[model samples]
Target: MNLLGRGALAPAVPVFRVFGAMNARAPSASLAPDVASRTALAVHNIEVVYDHVVLVLKGVSLEVPEGSIVTLLGANGAGKTTTLKAISNLLHAERGEVTKGSITFYGEEVHRLSPNELVRRGCIQVMEGRRCFAHLTVEENLLTGAFTRKDGRAAIQADLEMVYSYFPRLKERRRSLAGYTSGGEQQMCAIGRALMARPRLVLLDEPSMGLAPQLVEEIFEIVDQLNRNEKVTFLVAEQNTNVALRYARYGYILENGRVVLDGPAEALRDNEDVKEFYLGLSATGRKSFRDIKSYKRRKRWL
Candidate 1:
């Protein structure tokens, strides 16, 4: 069956591109004036601190234009998840807080909003690990995402069908307990649940985690479909650089809590450093683990 349905066209507006970290002195110059007006989210020189002591993110800044797919690429412990949590206002739950800088959603400062308040304003996070309620049936798990909505059942039911349309597999297993489903299905359930909230911006953390390559492709394909047809904006934090770059229009690379490099996806894909380090391919040939490890010490961005 066709999951994307009709009216799925490529985004009309060009993605606003920013390279390197935004200059603290000239932050306004990072994005073109026209493009800035269309931004869905903007994080400016933000710093995240855990336990009021350990710093996690340092002066990281980026933008996600409305109706576009943006990817955050990095290895484990690179602050990718922390950045998403900061944007979603989920940091307080873990004793983390944004100590500096500002975050804005749709041109309004939102760093101080509560998590559920953020959800009510149409921004939500589909957390890592597909955190589904294990005992809840698949459909029930999806319904939980709509808890903040005051819209009548008719509207909610229409959206439920819309979520099922994007994920027919969810419809097939609607009665099955979420814990009994496969990893891929659980990932779908997580994303489907976010859709039930009728979100405008979905912060997706590691959607490909623990899934097979084919399943990863399926998950990303669904994300693309949602962006194209439903006009949902996505900010995906992923470790799989190749796949993320293939689907995202723009990307930011994080390391040690700092944004070291960022640009249009095609530019990043062909970049020498990205090809050698992230893609495991150098001008000579594919490198072994030992070669990559040796090259890591001299990463140009460092």
Candidate 2:
């Protein structure tokens, strides 16, 4: 049932091979938290480059409010993963660098901190592709998340139980090699591992990729529960706008590495442009819009 096959421990599985760059000027703080006091993670106009030539992420900016779920939505190759890596400082390994702008977490400059330091500060990024240690057991992979922690064993053990509570399927596969687990279980293992880090902010990349619709819903339900019950804030980058918006309080739509639109999730669901361009709907799903405006007055989405 291993839908992901033998991918090994590639947490940030590379999907796109190309990168590009442009002059990145910090955008206005319009997207910064309305209450600066509640901001957990902030990225201001960052430019990313690969191998000092190919550039990606042209001055992207956004904010994740403390203890809130925010969805970053876009199509494939929209620089979503790059933005997450830019914040986690993982770009360096890929010959990628944030050539412009800044990132802050809990009011501390993230560029100045190592990846481990960010984890220590309760910031973690659960990379895409549901990467699990192919040779290791599910429990072992989950324990790896706590490798940077020096906290007492008791706390870690308690957290392990908590992860099991959130992902019972992972518990069922606890002793199985991660490589053999189903795609859904591996995805659960990835998120459970991040939880072991006790992160205050989790940058989740594509939680719904390569799974059955039912499994996707189940995982998202767990995410919502974790957010509500544990106060774990999430900034999820996903292409599945329909599912993501259901749980997110706010959303930002990115296209070609730029913020094209952003607003409360409900408002986005009603936007003509979003409905057509992102949702693939041509004002045909809802009849209320037609009732509210004449056909001639309806805004053009394309």
TM-score of each: 0.87, 0.83
lDDT of 2: 0.79
> What tens-digit string does per-residue lDDT give for candidate 1 at 119-140?
9999999999999999999999
Which segments of candidate 2 are over 4 A away from where they belong? 1-37, 286-302
Best by TM-score: 1
Global lDDT for candidate 1? 0.84
> Candidate 2 on 208-253: residue-level lDDT in tens?
9999999999989999999989999999999888899888878877
> Which 10-residue window of candidate 2 scores lowest in summed lDDT?
1-10
Stretches of candidate 1 exceeding 4 Å from the true structure: 1-37, 289-302
Model 1 TM-score on a 0 to 1 scale: 0.87
Estimate every model's Cα lDDT from 0 to 1. 0.84, 0.79
